[model samples]
Target: MMKNYITKEVLPFEGERRDLANVAREMFNRKMTNVAGGNISVKVTPDENFSYDEVIYEKGHDYLLMTPTFMSEAWYAKLNPSQILVIDLKNGKKLSGEGRLTREINMHEEAYKANPKIHVVYHSHALNCMFWATLGQDMPNLTEVTSVNVPLGKIKCLPYRTACTKELADLVYEELIKLGDKSEQNIFLLNSHGVLITDTDLHSATEVLETVEWNADIAYKQAIFKKLGIIENYQSCGNSLTI
Candidate 1:
């Protein structure tokens, strides 16, 4: 019954299928998810054949598809597309029963509404992002790498709210708008929560999250080495080369 429901109305595309699997694997391998910690979703394009006002482009088709919650990231990596829930955004209906739609579905909805260009949303409690959040530090654009990706814009922080509350949704919506005309690649730190990463597609979205963690890891390690007074002279280590 669960398998039948999940596979019922999903659109089959090898690219999207592979993307989903890759994201799941990467998240697990990187320990982005400890046990069952994060969720990933991809938005489906509305069908061109359907009229603008039509509700059902096709009975079985879904506007969004997501992985099941509570499954270990490693376990989720092995799940078939049929094991994920297919959600109809038009009416907030779930066409599949493999698992209930995540309560944070509103987060994805709000992000999509704010930025039509975003096709993927990833929410994870990454250690580095979380460390900054816990310290209540604004994620600084200190280095070229951090500035290039996260940039110099403010890292919007949403206050603690119930995971699925209307307040939480509203906060995220407002923050995105507050980002204003700046670069759309800003990363938002959810206070006492997790990181909300959105992007043009699943692959890019995953990359953005990876970059954030990478920067954080680098910063943390550098701070530790500095405390130990172990800084090495990079100029002395190698011969200079003209570019």
Candidate 2:
């Protein structure tokens, strides 16, 4: 069952769906996820003055605004504000928007249940991130940013859990709660599925998304080098390749 926990403060959503579209497009353009793969969401306190079909909403109540689950081929990249859904996470109710959310919503809810500070979540099927997930190993830190940013050594690659199941969500929730407030470590590599990241804002969430993938790519290259017996000496990535 969906439930609400301690809320730090009410941050009502002020922008239109296009605001979410910008980030979603960025992830898509960067080849972070397939057209229908990743999903993005944000928790917000509904505006008291706003009403749905004549029913007014309470300002302090938390609601999730997210993208549509099923979309036409081109719609994923050209997402519109009208395509976003606003749902009441408390009782699993839909407040607005057309179509259902991605099955990954369960994991997103679990993240919110674990930490009140998290306001946004991005789950993508990025190639590199998913590559690490299949191995069930901590991503090697060839770069300092990956070590410090994904401070848990590497992004946690969750064990095999069926997508949309309570077990999957709970594991992700518990894993994140243990980290306390390190929202950047929000990255979660789902076993045989994909990746998830929780953040207080879109900016920081997007920032780490690129870094994690870069680290994963670097690790892949290192593995290849080791296979070919290129070099045993340390190859430090002194600068961030987070572009």
Candidate 3:
């Protein structure tokens, strides 16, 4: 059942927040996520409009602006502005906006808490990404582009859990921490689910998402080459990735 905090209405957001929404629409259009898959969130501090969970998140600390679950729609449908739900992260409660907040709300919340410096998170059902997630494989930095900004070290994957549950959120938090400090984790794969990327903002997170998906796709193709004996004797640059 979809829960509502207020009447159905198209709410307006400021410039940066609006940019976040636009980027989300672009992410959707880019096939990073379908109507049913994927959610985007940004950490925001307490403001004049919201005043709950002050003690939990600290008066001036960051919370989240989570998109509500999209109802039945085509894959290419645009999400209205009213669909965005503001959440008080201290507790994943809907602070404003309408419609039900995403079932993955807890996942987004725990991710923010897992990394203090990560102010943005993008969880998407990007193709090729789901390939590695299901195969229990990790994304190795296979290119100079991915090797520098993204680490060659494997991005960890967690076991599957029912989405929108505390268990799922906890599993993500546990795996995300292995990437080192909260701020260092570039991306994580949720088993049989999707990819999650953390960054200082939406655009940066989007970049990481693109790079990670490319790496995932490349890694799979390389594995195919190995299987076909096309690169049976391939060697690496003294690393896990094959050449």
- Each prediction's TM-score against the native? 0.74, 0.83, 0.80
lDDT of 3 by residue, 1-243 (tens): 732232213332344556766787787777777656687888876433322233222346456776666622432425555556667677677666667776787787777777787788778888888888887666555755566655535666767787778998898777667655644447778787888887777787888888777877777787888889887533334455443
Winner on TM-score between 1 and 2 is: 2
Ranked by TM-score, top first: 2, 3, 1
Locate the minimum summed-lDDT window of 10 residues in model 3: 3-12
Model 1: lDDT of residue 216: 65
Off by over 4 Å in 3: 1-13, 46-59, 71-77, 182-185, 233-243
lDDT of 2 by residue, 90-146 (tens): 976776676777777888888898888889888888888778888876566666676
Top-lDDT structure, candidate number = 2
How high a TM-score does candidate 2 get? 0.83
**Overall lDDT per candidate, in order of appearance:** 0.64, 0.73, 0.68
**Model 2 weakest 10-residue run by lDDT:** 3-12
Candidate 1 C-alpha lDDT tens digits along 1-243: 322112323344334655676777678678775664677888776343342222334533447777777645447456665556667766778765356577788887887777766677778888887877676565533344555544544555567766777888887778777665442455777777778877667777777777777766665565566567675311111332111
Please give the RMSD of candidate 2 to the true structure.
6.3
